[model samples]
Target: MSLGSAFQTLCGALFEDSMTLVCSAVVPESLTKKYRNRMISPRDPYSIYQLDSINSSYLLVFHFEDMPDCRTIQLTDMHNLNCTSHTGEEKNLYFGYSHRMCYNYTLDLTTELKHHCGARGYEENMQSGYYYTNHDPNPDIRSDVSGGSLLGSPTLVICLIVSLLLIALLHWKTSRL
Candidate 1:
């Protein structure tokens, strides 16, 4: 049904090595290409204006070169999965064994522990709903985004009154002339 499932079937049929994982990570890269523009509004044909008078319309093309190499399972020397400390804790996960090499011995699981703890804390938020883009086609109906500047406060009211009076005065003067 899925790509992973198809891959599994193919691997089972052909290859001896067991298929492990297929993870994808995206990183932004600035790309530029030209194509035809198609943002025409059917409702208001007369309101259509040219972005560029010389150029008619163009499309932005983003090219994907190749599939990323992420099809492998790096075997680690995880001798013991379940381990315990000197003080005798309930249960411990054997992260990595200490090696007395020339390099620095920095084997701290505090980061990983904190990460898992934080993840657990966000269980409620995760259960709520999935995230979306700022420019999502169907934006949240409840949001009062407000396209332009809002007319609020006493200062704005006074300014508006003054403008109206000035306009009225100008019209009166023109009429008299």
Candidate 2:
């Protein structure tokens, strides 16, 4: 079977609903160059090997309503789908490598150029790996109690109570005088 057909079959079997293949291309030389000397382990969420025997590598991008199960994909020849990284609610990209002419896919979410894969049930998978590029209209703002509103801090509330007590004491003393 052609690599393209294999990918389509894999996706069809993996995802419950029909998904769209947004993009597919040969993995950029510049990107592959970065991993020339890097050691890739089977346990790693992503893998990049210097297999001179394989002439070319490809990157496949797919759009899905929900992420496919990482465990199920791990069972396939594609191996694990890096479940921790994602671009948006409905988009994911997979990095495929040629191993002895058969595609040995790896989930390369760490790459800066492409959107990462999302795994099932992992909340972190919903977050985009490219934080700098994310122009979130309603970004979450986290603040400590001290840095937040004055009424929200216990220390400030105690201080206000103490100040009020001190003022009452002073007023009572002046009225007595």
TM-score of each: 0.18, 0.20
- List where candidate 2 sits over 4 angstroms from the true fold: 1-148
Q: How accurate locally is residue 42 in candidate 2, as Cα lDDT from 0 to 100?
A: 21
Highest lDDT: give the candidate number.
2
Global Cα lDDT for candidate 1: 0.24
Cα lDDT tens digits, model 1, 1-177, are 654344333222212221221212221121101211122111211101111211111111011111112122211222111212224332322222211111012212212222322322211110110001122223233245464434665777899999999999999999999
User: Where in model 1 is the C-alpha error above 4 Å?
Assistant: 1-26, 30-132, 135-142, 145-159
lDDT (C-alpha, whole model) for all candidates: 0.24, 0.32
The TM-score of candidate 1 is 0.18
lDDT of 2 by residue, 8-127 (tens): 454333323222222222334455466551322222233221111221222222222122222112112332232322333332233333221223344344333233232222211111
Worst 10 residues of 2 by lDDT: 125-134
